[model samples]
Target: MSTAPQGTTGGKTGPARETFSSRKLFIISAIGSAVGLGNIWRFPYVAYENGGGAFLIPYLAALLSAGIPLLFLDYAVGHKFRGSAPLAYRRLNRGAEVLGWWQVLVCCVIAIYYAVIIGWAAMYTWFSVTKAWGDDAEAFFFGEYLQAPEEPALGFDFVPGVVYPLLAVWILTIVIMVAGVRKGISRANVIFMPMLLVMFLVLVATSLTLPGAMDGLNAFFTPDWEALAHPGVWAAAYGHIFFSLSVAFGIMITYSSYLKRKTDLTGSGMVVAFSNSGFEILAGIGVFAAIGFMAFTAGSTVEDTAVAGIGLAFIAFPTLVSQAPLGSLIGVLFFGSLVFAGLTSLISILEVIVAAVQDKLGWARVKASLAVSVPVALISLVLLPTTTGLFVLDISDAFVNQFGILAGALVAVVVLAWVLRKLPMLSGHLNRISSVKMRTTWMVLVAGVVPVVLAYILVNEIIAKVSEPYAGYPAWMLNTFGWGMSIGLVVLAVLLTLIPWGSGSKDKHDPEYEAIRAAEDKEEAR
Candidate 1:
């Protein structure tokens, strides 16, 4: 159907949906979405903590057997159905529309907290010049900078420093989202992705020249070959790859929905997947190298200094900046990379929600962008810049990521593959025009292997989180932000699915899709 030539259309009610001007732009944009802060700040720690060099084996296996296959699955559904996540799933099977809304609500929770991190990175890029976190990096980060109080108690006391930067970040995000597909997303990818690669390359080179750099390198690469036998290690590999690639949620599906009918989806999936992993490897090198310098200064080991997420970005790297030669340069490049990588991923996450709203309400791109994003920005502003913001971010991230993304993904594959039985049709759509074919092998991976990995990861997460209060927060905080937030998304998703789609929804009976289906049907009959 994808390969069929164009013909007359009959069902569209509004202007044609936007498309990527070229496949090159689509690939760049997809890679931009995939390569995010986790690549720079989180992957190195995951690799080191998992199995050092031996982690690559499981990571590669997970990428091939799960990540890429699931990516292809997302591409197939979005391209074939020609709609946003809810719309696409609705088109696939009416009962499945709830899954789409589930993914969108997940993005909503993610977007609210995610922007604050990006804002932090943007500010730190400048603080690098002044060495603002003087003396004790930890004290400054927690005390003067974040102003986070000792307890996890509730408060709306906004820190002016964080509020200003966060406001700037939201404004920038809204401007890009309002610009529409080609003008907004594709162009940002072209500008930001290249800049990210080059800046990160320089950061890596500079980190390698730091004193004790070889020690960090050795620690990072010294395969604790024994670690490979652990199922937990392999599970970590599979779990991180899902988050790293930005799959299972709605990001990839919404992005692919904008492609031209005959796009080379599977081939593009391969490029995006490998490129994302490649960036992760580079990040491990640079981060560990910097960690080595920190260890050298402290007369400790790289293992002592190595950390991930907020601690790695704000605390560890700041200490490195104060001590190492060319430290200021390292801080600038590293935080700058975070800013670029973070913006790209945040843009993609928000698009999943905005596009879903657009499809349901049938609004113009600008109206939809403002309607959805303004409320999102307001929520983020009100909730996340306060003194207790970090606690909320941490607890919410633990719950939402595990239940919303991991559990939600598990549900999607099971329902689509086992219940509705849609993989065969989606596979056919991929094989029709994709340079890489999806036949029995792709089917087995998506329908059989992918769900099992997701389910294993989900169950383990549930057990661990339920068994203990995450990050040692009080019961009230965990119950409100973590459990309550995840459950609320599910309930809202069901309610959203019940509402009728608006008249302006272009794909209610998509003419482009039907025309191609009819042409392919005629061809198949012949």
Candidate 2:
């Protein structure tokens, strides 16, 4: 195993990895990655379904035990190794190189579908004006807007409505990613994140003024406490926290690799974790408030109007916009926030793929970005823009989140904690650089509690899928798009690892390699 020293250029072997321009830039960029559609679109709905207010108990619990700790683990590995996921893992244990590639490939898969969702948001941002979704928001979104097919299958028939916006999304993402980390991602986040928060706050304020806003707030916070006892609710909380925090998909690891050597790893993780959760709570208030308004207008209850994921974003929100005071302005603010959130997340996802390629193949940043982005763009334009694209996206998102990311995180924890026995050393590294030192409890959560909980979630998901087709989709659909895609990722990961690690001037000769090796030896001796 080899390691690259902090701030050293790989020279002939790899392009020099760039550090973030400042600590503030790093934290902002990281928060941009963590606070995405998951918070605004997914969290509210997951909370509503799980226990409304009661879900917060398990959600925060998962955050403390699993989310923040795993984030710290990612930070320690990348900051210590000063490389991408594959490089970091390879340096840790040559045999575990495949785990790194697995996460990278998972990001690649996520990028394609994620871009499509962003494209949808992009289109909705424009459609917000004049209430283009018309009177029947659900029908307009599903039928007139998407023209979703009667059945799901791979088809190339492009929907111009979807394609045009999707094209714009790819172009925007490419420009930012090609610009390099500090100038592109960090700068973009600085502008996008604050603006997103302001617009969302305004939306929440307006919703509070609407009739029945209290009802919506009540439904959102009023938890079904009994639901907390259900294992499924706990699983959902962990799953939501995992996806919402954006860990185990190579994004955090790659971003941490760009941090300066003196950066505070644990403090950064805590900021990102808490910032992400705080935003979700805000989104919940805004979302449910709006939903309550919708129910009031329709002479119904909050439960009747409540939705999640794409439905909440496109259908329910658009409907509320049409009926709200200053309908057009409110609509713009709502959809615009989605675009900002989605763009930041999309850039982070693409960077994970770009970083992995640059490290493995020694490609320049622009070249690596293009190499990964082109294929993903083609997929989004060709497959995801079709009328049936949403269906494909739905199944793909479910499978990837459940099997791809959760499985990857589970493996990473096992390797670092059990196989390599590096949890203590990793914690020590965090304490050294961070103002907020990690206690033994963090180690217990990362090495013991987190892994067990993650395993339970994975096993439960597998059993549910095996017992019946997911969401009542056809067996072949689940088998092909769901199971097939998850298996394909593993195959791709193994194949990627088989490629020879390229040659370079600083490949195996960096001083950091010896330093890390010495640390590991000392730990093992203890």
Q: What is the C-alpha lDDT of each candidate?
A: 0.89, 0.84
**TM of each candidate vs. truth:** 0.97, 0.94
Tens digit of per-residue lDDT, candidate 1, span 1-526? 1333332224334445678888999899999999988898888999999999999999999999999999998898888787889989998888899999999999999999999999999889999989999998899888998899987789999998889999999999999999988899888889999999999999999999999999999999999899999999999999999899899899999999889877889999999999999999999999998899889999998888899999999999999999989889989999999999999999999999989988887777898999999999999999999998989999888899899999889899999899999888888888887788889998899889999999888888888888987888999998899999999999999999888877667446456667756775675566
- Which residue runs does candidate 2 get wrong by more than 4 Å? 1-14, 505-526
Give the candidate number with the greatest lDDT: 1
Candidate of highest TM-score: 1
* Model 2, TM vs. native: 0.94
